[model samples]
Target: MPPPRDTSVKSTVIPFDPAAPNARLRRLVHHDVLERWRAADRSAHAPRIVAVPGGDGDDWAAAALVTARPHTAYLKIVDAVGDVPTAVEAVVSHARDRGLAQVKWEGWTVNPEVAALGFVPLSVPLAQDAESSGPGAGHVRWLHDGEVTEPPYYGQTTHFTCGAVTALVAQAHAGELARESFDRRAELTLWRDATNFPACEPVGLGVAVRRAWPSSPVTVLLDTERPVLLDQYPQDEQEWRAVLQRASREEAGRIGVPIDSHPLSMTTVRSALGRREHVLLLVSLADMQGFDVPHWVLCHGAVPGALVIEDPWTHTAAGDTWVDAHLLPVPDLSLDAMSTISPDRIRGAVIIGRTEA
Candidate 1:
């Protein structure tokens, strides 16, 4: 709307000592974040590491290369030090120097922190003439003028937690990630391809498979509905409320906000091992019994104000269809199971900013 905040504005990366008195790079997120991306699949010749900067100013930041023609690259910055806005500018400059433009940018927060920092939402403004899908769309935002890379709420890659991983699968089938900035509707359902999905990601090297083919279906080891949401998002009511309000003007009640719109404080995003994941639909305690809970789904890269609640539970398991058809008399799941249980689930919803109506 506001002429799409100018992402073209560039800034130079300030060289700072990691041990300096007031440096921002030490708190940056890219160095460690690269490990997770690499862990996804390093052997694949297509994606490989290009740069990992050091020192305090370089914290929480990493540069990577996508092994494709034209040598596509990305700069991922999470929990960056100092002003995030400046870091984003530096990234743009760095990309330009590498003979590249634009970025497949991403961030994790209820507010459009990165967007405000010059990165654009891939879905909100929508890319007018960019290629719709395939390798082209994945890296299109970085190449075109006035292109914005707004990823759908669900398909966005969050921290490497079981909840984020499971929710990614759920969003895939539910159609949360398909809406691209361009008119093209990317196929998130491709993740459901058992044979095509990456197996090493879900199970790791402990369980070696017979053969790593392009079409082998490995049973998804991650539990699809284990209450892992809190692990992924982990933000409490206050933070969630603040972020939701900043992202959109939706009714707080719809997002489970209390009448006062205040929920208890939460610990850091990090949780202890063995904490169960949050799965299924989640609503704030305040909105559970509202007369009409509006469920909005993202279509064509925007939140279409439509209500579709055929099944009470937003997520249905592979066996759920059979169970609902034969074993259960009722079509909808009980509301108790759909509400948020932890920070990960609630936080993710707030960050993605969608209503399942």
Candidate 2:
């Protein structure tokens, strides 16, 4: 392969300004394929962008998107017109300023040069890592330690209903129904009931719960009013914001849940667990899926240095399908890092079941 083109680029990292005139988000995203979260995805923390000075009388050199999630400020997306190393430096500088552990790149979609940089996946690449989970594997540390097992495993049949499947697991654990009876696996009726199609968001499923059980004590908590997956992301913030705001309002009004525009905490989640409250949590799957995306899993209990998760997605790695999905223990710091919906959106879990009178 030919050596990467070098243009003696000088790049700077800046917080993405969605409201700026002639904002370059749409064009940038098209260039940065691995950057998962769009402006529509930013219910709270908008990601930072890298800007490079134009060379040879050119208008620009390069641009890229980076995130501020706890694990690492991800550097997986870029629109390069010059030296990639300079752009990488700009992203790294921003990550260091934020006091993050590392800068991550895409594991699945990494090109040859990016792969040569040798950034591993933020979390274990697969659910079953033999080295990580060997004879003394931490993954098996919480196997039978009374960490609220019996929630049962029912994977998502469709790609979009991770939220619904996670909710079902929580409901079962909360005594809304027994595990076996609740195994609807892939029938997708529950997801269809929960989701707002076309937009592909898992909103208003809480209303379905109340409808099924009139006396159910489920409380739906939402932290943002942003419409999900909007038009492959609009370059104009206001043009996008109008549609986002409208959808959020409609969804919130229809679901009848109060929409909070702030962060939630893991401590709150722990408190709910203490009261035998099972929770459906919104987490970034950067660790699991190789880039940041909204994913839901049922939190069974907290163990030493980790949280036990009952993931709704089936483990893709063979022979360890059930082994990996059932009560998977993610490292505490890693769990803490991934347990958010947005940068500013803390505690993105919806606590349901058995509210006090």
Candidate 3:
């Protein structure tokens, strides 16, 4: 059995000096908590760390670590200031500053106040829970049948690289990324090979997969009809979505992945899985926590009515929790809502096929 969590943290509030370096922020929060945050910084997908000063004394008070996701920033509270209510206040305030959309901390099970703070438990969603209009089951039970997993879980170095990371995981699933560890070096290599510099388009991800794993092939699927939300461009809103899609197609073809002028849908995803091929799909974070940016995930199996997803970014601590949501089933209903390309809502996907042994 595991040991109980420490709840004896107590500190006096102290004002922060702007002139001071970030190293000083560590002295303000719990040493134990800061220690863990330090460890997280070593990873490629580490959070952007910061601290909110405590008042009056030298005691380190409130601290949080933030990371940018699809369309919003994710804030995770590391050290609480006081009782549950007070501690929650510290978190909410910091998140508010960044216009944060999703909030999760470690201690939700013990304190109901965390819920009262408009925060929810980072529950691992299952496929069986969501109602679907498609097949029989709603989760990816077949992933556990010994056909899916291979290279295993490795967190992304940057939030924008989820597509690249997903591609790597997909390659691993196809036995193309054979290695002892898909560590920071491997992740950066994929990112370097894939990134469209400013935007993370699907084609860039497909391109990276092909460059890194020659044995396995990926198809970059795009809608032949152009998206109409052209006006929404450059606002960090919808304009870039169209830009990336066009660029992804052009670049995907340039990189040699079978670029398809066909639209993507649940049928496309299912067809790939049926052929024992892995899919790297783009989705919106808004449907889950109200952010509207393109995100990528690996889809390996399906339940009766839903697709099984293994997200690159989960609530796991660094390497502590690698494979999250083995049973993470995305019902057809919720899946469609999130998988559609922004503004245009056109479906897009990059299906990774088996390795040539």
Best by lDDT: 3
lDDT of 2 by residue, 1-357 (tens): 212322333566667654451244443334344333322343123456676655653443556555332232223332332455566556555544544323444232334455443332222222222222211111111112233345555656556777777776776666766655664442266665555552224345555454455455555555655554344454575365445446645655664554444566667667767777776777777665555666778777765445667776643321123334555555556776787655434445555657345
As for lDDT, the candidate ahead, 1 or 3, is 3
TM-scores, all models, native as reference = 0.26, 0.51, 0.53
Q: lDDT per model, in order?
A: 0.27, 0.50, 0.54
lDDT of 1: 0.27
Rank list by TM-score: 3, 2, 1
| Candidate 3 structure quality by residue, lDDT tens digits, 1-357 | 111212332332233232332554646445565555454422333344444344665443454443322222334443343344545455455444544322445441255455445443342221111211111111111211233233355456566567777776666656666645555677767777666553456666777677777777778776644633244455565565666557656765676788786767788788888898988877876754355777777888765556767676653333213222322456666776788867767666788888777
Candidate 3 Cα errors over 4 Å, as ranges: 1-151, 224-251, 315-327
- Model 2 spans > 4 angstroms off: 1-147, 183-187, 198-203, 229-256, 315-320, 342-347, 355-357
In angstroms, give how far residue 42 of model 1 lies from its true place. Answer: 4.9
Q: How much is 314 displaced in model 3, in angstroms?
A: 2.7
lDDT for 202 (candidate 2): 32
Q: Each prediction's Cα RMSD? A: 22.2, 15.5, 13.7
- Candidate 3 least-lDDT 10 residues: 132-141
